[model samples]
Target: MIHNKYFSEEQIKTRKQQMSSQWDTVLKTNEAVLIHSGEPIQKPGGLDSTYPFLPHPAYFWLTLRRRETEILLYSKDLGWIEFHKEISNEEIFWEGEKNDILISSQGKNINSLENFLENHRFSRIFHLGQAKDASPEAFELKTLLDKTRRKKDASEVSFIRHIAEIANSGYQKITSVLQPGMTERELQIAYESEIFRNGAHTVPYETIVGSGSNSAILHALPSQKIIKENEFVLVDAGADIFDYCVDVTRTFYSSGEMSSQHKDLYSIVLKAYHECVAMSKAGVFWRDVHIHSAKVITEGLLQLGILKGNLSDLIEKEIVSLFYSHGVGHLVGLRVRDTGQEENLNPKTYFGARLRVDLELEENHLITVEPGCYFMPAILESAYQQKKFYDDINWTELKKWYDIGGVRIEDNILIKNDGNENLTNCIAKTEY
Candidate 1:
């Protein structure tokens, strides 16, 4: 089906040209822009071994390539230029052929930047990547980049759909092999193998495989803990073919039918996922969607006796944060947990601090509608101490449900003016 990677050189060049127009609007007579493909870090205590390298999101947005230490430069005069680190015969021998997603960017040697930097010395540079003192402040330019990134281009939408299909294969693998006594790590291997085997260029992030009580620990690495009977196994995983991304999470019952209690918790999260996804049309505020998910979850919790309070008060007090922590989801594309230029949204807003992307939902935006309900010990404990909202929670009732751990069902959503699309809905939540 030709889905491993889809960005062609021509498409990348077209994207670059679009960026050039944006750059032209910002860069003055002598100003330039330098976006960096970041350097790889050597593994600690290992002299030569290094972790896998994924370029800076900004740099990858322009080049769609994954070479380290490369630079994409833009100026009104020079237009678009890529500077590849001059390679050595030793590097060529060890690394073999420098094959990458081909781009027609005929760039200069990194050393040539010495002459260019000295000659044109930009009046005010707009930098979008790292490395020290590379350019001037990039406040306005970054805003342009972030605003542009919020909406997926046509090719970006196509690639995300393809990756979601690949990721579903992995989810199916885990669901099929689920049995008692298997360690979480073993399940992770089964899931990862299928994705890579099915042609995912890489996993967008660490594949999470948490079963039983461990599932409450969001983003935990798969462990050796044995999977007991029919407990919940929560997996948050996705695929990356050329860094085209999808972040999907599905919680599964280890064996046959789940218990009624387990079913209730799962259903709550499932309902929240549905409600949030349905709310993802253009012009809706993303934060309002998050609150809507919280309301749905709080309603479920109230029914289950885990929480007891007025719906509005429960949501406003962040009482739902006790059970459903973390933002419903964030923008997922060129990078997982995208480094959104959305400013410091991460202020301890209690929906688990890292929740950033909160722009008004717009057409063509790709986001994740991942509302979760967990019986996390840490969150429950802290909320108990918040005396003001103390009476609202049913702390004692939560004890009975702690063993179910957590339940999260996520899907990538493509926002539209009329409606929204659930890109990963094929990775089913029930009756599989």
Candidate 2:
């Protein structure tokens, strides 16, 4: 059985009030006639079982409830209204009683949903997308609530901090007991067990415990491969606490003694990590931060004789994509990849092309700053085939480190008005 916990009633009320105010402003400004919530979903093949229900982040941001068959309707004059199905005794016996924590805490006004369609009709309904139960005439909302969700409120920050603490504890547990010959799968179990023991509801994403050559794969799955001495282990994992997530990554040397090449590469990645953290502040464009991180990695590779050309010229030519392809970071909140976007930001560059969130940093914005360098044959070979950066890259020297795999150091950061705060700062770096 899974144990559940929630924020205090006062905290829930505050979040509700904030959401209501935001909705009020949005409805009035857009002159929306009505706003309708999306419906829930169920599994296809299961007889009576449903997939783990995760409410739409926008819906949860408003109602905090993960109900399966409920809809929220809002109007400027009527305020927020909920239509809900009355639970039967059979359901109570089979599925357990409805907690109604949100209703009781906020004293929400709910109405029978049996005849909702017959009683109400809307001409201009704003919705995120089409739903089976929603009106076909509904028009898409120009700006989604995702934009407003960028800057978290007090309660959100608290939840994320708790997640970070849990993640830190899990990392500490794994590092203290890790040993050579342990399978990647074993490490995954140990880390996940620690997360559950510390009160995390579930892992935010798949637990990555990549060892040896597997570390070169950015999103490698934990396998039965046994870790060996002198190899690197890249563990990128996080836990979910009440839907809030914390993403963290750490790379460790299996022998507990870093090789000369490993030391040099680790130092460079660590420097890039800290430099990105220092540069993440309110009003800073995320694209600029990404570019700065790529430049740092490019410069480091050049110093290591891995690349051959002027630093600026190499970076401008997208040579950094050969090693550090993924984005330096992304927004983190209710979901691991939080929903938000900037109209002017384009994340189509060869480097940092997979950026999930691209917007100017704002106060209370939580994100992950993960910088990495990998020796992946496919990515490098593809670039070489395209004749991209052939002059800047020293393929012969890079080939020597192919077996070295990769190194990544990641942390959760909260952007502040003055600067930023690293939420996972308590977690020790793998260099130790």
Candidate 3:
């Protein structure tokens, strides 16, 4: 069913052609393909209840269908063949009537699995991922698909742009109604309802609404604690539209006015955010961008009397990890953290260890540039005990902002040939 009408028939056709061309380039001799659409799982201890059905990312990338127990077959001779299970009257009674959007787009190549397998034979069957009851050979097709899918096509870009718009709308709605005394869960409801009202059926991930000290915890879940005046509210959320997602994060001041210290920290994070986006372009190494962000954070901390050593020495010593722990950004597309074709560096340092994607930037690549600073008590105490920055640290000044929580500014960007496009730029960085 085309509940969301953002994508058209032409767009779907173009996407299929792109996937076919990309797959043909990577297929080897005597390799036939079988890509499975996964099924829904039952909830533990719930009678006849199941979790929401989500199609495999690769399967959705290929067919744009969310139905379970479907199989896609591909061979050099036969091309694309979709084997979908026929809907029964019992299914229709329970789940309503099925739509023919997928079938009409797939054409006459659709058939039953039994008939498809009986008519065609393959010396070697290679499955994209694990498929039930199939002993198919595993090849490098998964890696190839990941690499090919990194660069979004026009249709994919358009879809993501729509998703960005929805997410931006949600942020706007949440900010307008934000007030002191509201619980974090209430804020989450405000954000999610706005997204759904704007036409997104699902959020890409959990809606993060961290208030006060809770904001210091990365990936903090919504809690019952009431938001107090002058506290920092960090919201990181995304809208999922047709499997494509756009991640965005914005930190807000509950009282609509930032304290001097908070303003300084916010300015530093915003500066690092803009600098990272400016540096994002084809041929530039993502790791270099991350290092530059770290340097900016380190300089900001030094200016605030939090560190006393040379900037370069502090960055080299990974002292910035004491505040900015996660990576500067990551690949954002069909998956929030889209798989990078290359392997991560996995540096031993705290900051470097959090790097999600270490590949070079390329045209058509979609990524998120999020730079954050937090004053987590445990991490600070651990670093202090370990003597990681004992010589360079200024403990007194740091303690003043220890309970300030965190501040993060994130935006989605699409790398282009000439420059890049900021998809989430339409959303404001601050309430003012």
Candidate 4:
């Protein structure tokens, strides 16, 4: 385990340096740009979460450092500017204020929140209000920053790998205690407990614990349903550390039977998943990876008698979408679906092409390579009865394993110069 370090001023300053470098990429090119500490979240009333309350991630990313109720703006003309609430004497008496204490883990010297940006002069400074009035503030600083944050730097990559490490530890705890009689929620709690017990401030997203047929649902949430014997369980979960995240999914047997059907499906999914992961090299078109995965899915479905048509015709028509509708995967980082341009592949050709921005992989980009095949009885019945692509399917055998649910192989990856790095390797998503 890495030694835990609390937020300190030095760390804040170091992170600030990194943020400055990241901001330079976009801001340096524009004639005049405003880098803003994001607006505060609204509380129950009209009040905003301020000085003592936690600032949102966008706020943190731009400022590179902050305390409750503080805002910072940056531009070439106005080096670095700050804004804060005016601490009235009456307010101080009502709530004891510690003026000298370090506000951030980084030892940013203390200052009155109200006095940070009092006399700054920009052609126009950003304000936290409706978009109509601010002519000069045309673009949202947060949106622009989101686009910039898609790819991780070395430090951000380390943070994501650290999150994956913690998730692996949680996976270990669940493995030791997994059994048939346990409810899905029971398993979920156990998994989340381990995540929080470690350094994770929050989970990357909701934890999914789909057992048996529930696995067929692509994005199943954990419920109180009990797992059964001779059933396959699928779990997709992740953790967030310092705002960076890692997502992973695994399927296992409650009875540990390792059925032939289960093994066969696992093998196919793993094949498609790994093939896509291996294709994540610099300069490779993102659509090519999805095409490769689709081809593998087509061949696997043919072997299983799920699809029956001219292979080329079927692939061209996207007949395999019935079983594999989602994309190969998405970019991963600070946000589970981190920010980047949604311009990787053409939107019309790829089902979820919007998720594939920057399709040609770049060095240090992180992505998720998840490929899945599901036998959804509802989709099958509706499409088959209507003859909607029915000519492309072998209905008989597919119905035989209809209750067997689905299989998805997912992993978080780092796109490298020559190849890729699998960050979620330790999270154990499958028997493989």
**Which model scores highest in TM-score?**
1
RMSD of each: 2.6, 3.5, 2.9, 4.9
- Model 4 lDDT tens row, 1-432: 221333344554565555456555545422234333344466566563443333445555544443455555456544444554455688689766634322433222225432433544334444432344354333444444554555566656667777888998888878877899999999999889998898787787789888888998988998989988877788888897645689888877788768888888878888998788888987787778887888898888887777786777777777777778887877778667776453333564553333345367778778888888887889778845438776777767777888888888789888888998998897765545
Which candidate order results from sorting by TM-score in descending order? 1, 3, 2, 4
Give Cα distance to truth, residue 148, candidate 4, Å: 4.2
Model 3, span 87-205: residue lDDT tens: 67998999866563343445333355666576665666777645443332344566666766788877677778878888988899888988999999999998899999998878888
**Cα lDDT over the full model 2:** 0.75
What is the TM-score (0 to 1) of candidate 3?
Answer: 0.91
TM-score against native, each model:
0.92, 0.88, 0.91, 0.80
lDDT of 1 by residue, 25-108 (tens): 877887888888898999999899999777888887777666888888888987888887766899899986566534545678
Against the reference, the lDDT scores of all candidates come to 0.79, 0.75, 0.79, 0.69
Evaluated at residue 219, the lDDT of candidate 3 is 95
TM-score of 1: 0.92
How would you order the candidates by lDDT, starting with the best?
Answer: 1, 3, 2, 4
Look at candidate 3 and give me any clashing residue pairs: none
**Least accurate 10 contiguous residues by lDDT in model 3:** 100-109
lDDT of 2 by residue, 1-432 (tens): 112334555654565465556666555432333223344455687677667766666666666666655556666665656555556899899878767324433323335443554455543456542344243223223243555677787767777777888888888888877889899999999999998999898999999988877898999999999999988899999999657798899998888678899898888899899889999999998888888889898899999998997888887777777788898888888888876563334655646466656678989888899989998887777844438667777889988888888999999889998999888887788653
Candidate 3, 103: how far from true, in Å? 6.5
